[model samples]
Target: MVINTGLANLNRYNLNFIIIFFYYAAIYGTIAVFEENMMIRSIKDIILLVISFITLFIIIFKKQQKDLFVLFVLFLFYIPIIIIPYMFLNLSEQSLLYGLKITILPIVMLFTGILLSNFIKKDKILNCFKGIFFIITATWLIQYFLGIEKLLNFGYEYGINVKHFYGYLRLPSTIGTPDGYAILLAFLSIIIERNIKNKKIKILFFIVSMVFILSSTIRSAIMYWLVAYITLFFLRVLTSRTKFIIYSSLLLIFVPIFLFIMSKVNNSLFSIHSLEDRLSHWNLIEFDPFSTKGIIGSGLGSVGASSVKLEEINRSLNGYAVDNQFLAIYYQIGILGIIIFLLIIFYILYVFFKKRSKGQLGIIIIIGTIVSCLFTNTLEIYPYNLYFWFYLGILIDEPELIETEY
Candidate 1:
């Protein structure tokens, strides 16, 4: 049984290498072509994550071996269960309704990955982006035909796309915008993570991805990528190779400091707005926690009574939707909601990094995505959700077993 299990794992590992190549083909290369396929864009990460979870539960029973932090995820996800329904009953609103659409993907995806940890093998995520040249070239051509490049540079208004939050246009390209595409590259690193043999590949991936992020001219995207990359670099120095504890410690310190500085710096080089507007957006608009909602919240899509009407929540915030996920979530779920959301993040990072798992790439990508999302609403969109889960599917299994057992 032991030998058979080992062989099966090896077989799956080899297959994953092939699967990942096509995965990134859709992610980095295809551009708007992937978007052309509406059904593809519609698929959510939660679906594959669910599959991964079921696959793992039946295989390893690695439940006992799962790191302490990840072990808590099962229960943490349920926090929304109580809050979502409660708000619906009390608030007489749709806050919970919209919030549900936004969060359900992550909750389902993460849960599936957690549940199926055993049978699934952790894959180095490289093959995912293997066909980048072909896919990207093809998509760029299509964009050319559609005049998307011109359309994007100037405005989303011309095309079917719409500009939202902070006066930025939204693209539905292969993986999406500068942040979306760049983060995908960063996330793709999860597959090549930490292996001395593939360090070049991973570093190169980071650089190329950053370039795409820059093209967006979105200060938030640039800042988020910078912070995540810098954090990863510094964390690498302190880490003792596979030293999980050191990695986590450094990440915690670096992230908050980086975010705070970005949030505050007045003469911040290359930021999106002038000093006055930036400050007003970041500091002045204090995240008004709906007092009445208390811990539970106003309801998934419930409306608020103060400042800006709850119905006009997205528009009143500056004729744009909330760019910050933390604030967006807080508004929907309240303080308890924020607390629950954060705890999940803390736990996931703890579990993900601790295994000294081949998730170094995944961690970086997640951090990059998180930082980028702070500035752009990547979480609420389509292909972004689909791509995030695909990356996640690679993250749930154990890479050690795949490499060693094979």
Candidate 2:
């Protein structure tokens, strides 16, 4: 692929942005471990806001593509839906700003991805992610061997405690949580499956990923990865007869082992109480046509991990950490906002399906994320949320950029 100097520079700039996002959590974790000013972590949001404005500026002045325009419009329409809820709820100004920060930044990232897709080559994107995966995996391994005391020191500044499962410390690595680490590993697994041609190397990577994911002890992440890979296996990895044989062999050989392992993990692996608690919490948020909260929601930033800092708002709303992404949106934005969000998501999925040959990886990841969202607020999770929207933009349309063989 031949590239002009300007385009090459743009590509480098865009790639650097992605790298920054990929390591944002790790950098914060390192700083926290050394007892540096924890407020620096909040700088990430400021940087994101700046990037959003820059992207908006560029889209307005340079690239006015019809699709991009439509997306911008949809987001514009959804903004009011959320704002009205905040007014009705009488939330503080700080809460409103926080709401806008979380909601708008991800949408801006989608714009960034679409605009930069042509400049950044597909192979370069994969290679960048591959390097990131290896580096993060190394950190995870080191953290695993560091013992709980050392790991606890890593996030104590942020009030994040070390989590354990079945007497094993859930390794957060450079990421802030085991769930985040596992989710990142799961995403890397999809990329490896789609791009790596060497059978032995691919198998090795898969084994590493699986071991780390299991070590994290995040059932939702594990389930998301399994569902995504199983779908990929049938769609791309094997012919019909081969798929049947391989699947049958897998069940026969692995199911017993899996069951045995689960028995050992017991409550950690299968917690009925946790499941019931989640369901009960979900039930508590159900929409009521007669209620103001049901019609317009409690308002954006009314409840969520971000809202926890707003002690008065959190207490008034009786908000704990909302585990479900969809429910979190519903609690903040109301029914209309969620409907618009779902429509946008489905619209993106439709575009992905239309270009399935080129976008199958996107399809698998989106499906996996949606499933993960049911059990956890995947969208609120840093880096994952950023990359998720960015990739959706990258895969939404066919880029005319040079492509190398997968």
Candidate 3:
């Protein structure tokens, strides 16, 4: 079963296809079955755990990768314990069910192994991830063409209305929610950017990603994507504090004021209910100094605030959770736990920002993603976080592991 990959390029071994297929199957397939009641969440959990750990163990014990591999596994185990409390928290039976996300362990671990395998060959790794991204895009388009992507949204006032076909097609493209997909696809422009080889290709790619985003109708994600894209695209503008301050004052400050004035004059013309919900949800944060739950907070998945919020939102019309990552982590782990979670994320960001050698733009997108998740809940979902870790682990690993000072 062993094969030699002496050259360490994708052509040497076809692991890219394997990784891509498993990734989408697990992510989207699980989503398709999640609501259908066919596959037990526990079964997918177990299979991924087996595949993930088996891959990690083989890599770690193998002669070529003992130290780095072991350290990597430990790193994976160490950080996510931030999420382990829901099992014991004092919460309702239904609230406790939310802890099923611990199942995310296997998926993260599986990607971890992919990271370990990919470190030896960075291009293959990137290619594989890009391939998976395209798989999602391709499959979605296929479904769209078949008319299967069509579904209706039950409007509270207007009954069921035709909805744009997007994520949740086959794989739970949850993060790829109409807006979320746009953001990822827009970022994909950075992924596929070549050596400034051809002008037409770049313009075409940019246009296509934009088309995807605009049609998605996720205003929040779209706004975020546009802002992040502009910032990263002309990063040189931020190279100096004076320049950043000047630009921020003029663009950031005036743009909002102008938009506000226009929206007021136009009666806030294009408001989406989802945006209203997000704005309304901000009150829940309210810089609440008074902690609701004490240490160990309302039992990991207990009914403290989230259930109340759900009742309020009516399970986002059976969506079952908030769209804010910060809230999601905080509700489950409490403020202290969220701090730990952010610290882990901050560590990754710090590394990327400090070491701009590893494709700085990609790192920017990665960090931007983490930052964006704080305002919205994408990490709690699979695939996004899984892909984040996979890309990040390899990007960081592409360079030699720096030795620590004694």
lDDT on C-alpha atoms for all candidate structures:
0.49, 0.70, 0.48
Segments of candidate 3 deviating more than 4 angstroms: 1-18, 26-37, 40-44, 55-88, 91-120, 129-180, 194-197, 240-273, 282-294, 299-320, 357-359, 399-406
Per-residue alpha-carbon lDDT of candidate 1 for residues 109-221, written as tens digits (9 for 90 to 100): 44444333444434433434445433543553455456545755644333233233344433434544444443444443333334425656657755555544444444655
lDDT of 2 at 238: 52
Reference-based TM-score of each model: 0.61, 0.86, 0.65
Q: Alpha-carbon error at 225 in model 2, in Å?
A: 0.5
Candidate 1 local lDDT, residue 45:
33
Per-residue lDDT over 1-406 for candidate 2, one digit per residue giving the tens place of the 0 to 100 score: 3546776687569677766765664445455455545377577777787778877887877756777777877777776786787555667777777667766577778888887776667676667677768877888788767877766564443225357665667766666667776787788767665666777777787787787777777888888898887665565545467767877788689878977887776557766666677888776675674577866788777766557546633444444567888888888877777787887778777776676556677777888989988988777766667777876777666632321123
Candidate 2 ranges with C-alpha deviation above 4 Å: 1-8, 33-39, 153-159, 234-267, 309-319, 399-406
Arranged by lDDT with the best first, the candidates are 2, 1, 3
Score residue 42 of candidate 3 by CA lDDT: 45
Point out the worst 10-residue segment of candidate 3 by lDDT.
153-162
Query: Top model by lDDT, which number?
Result: 2
In the order shown, what is each candidate's alpha-carbon RMSD?
A: 8.3, 3.7, 7.6
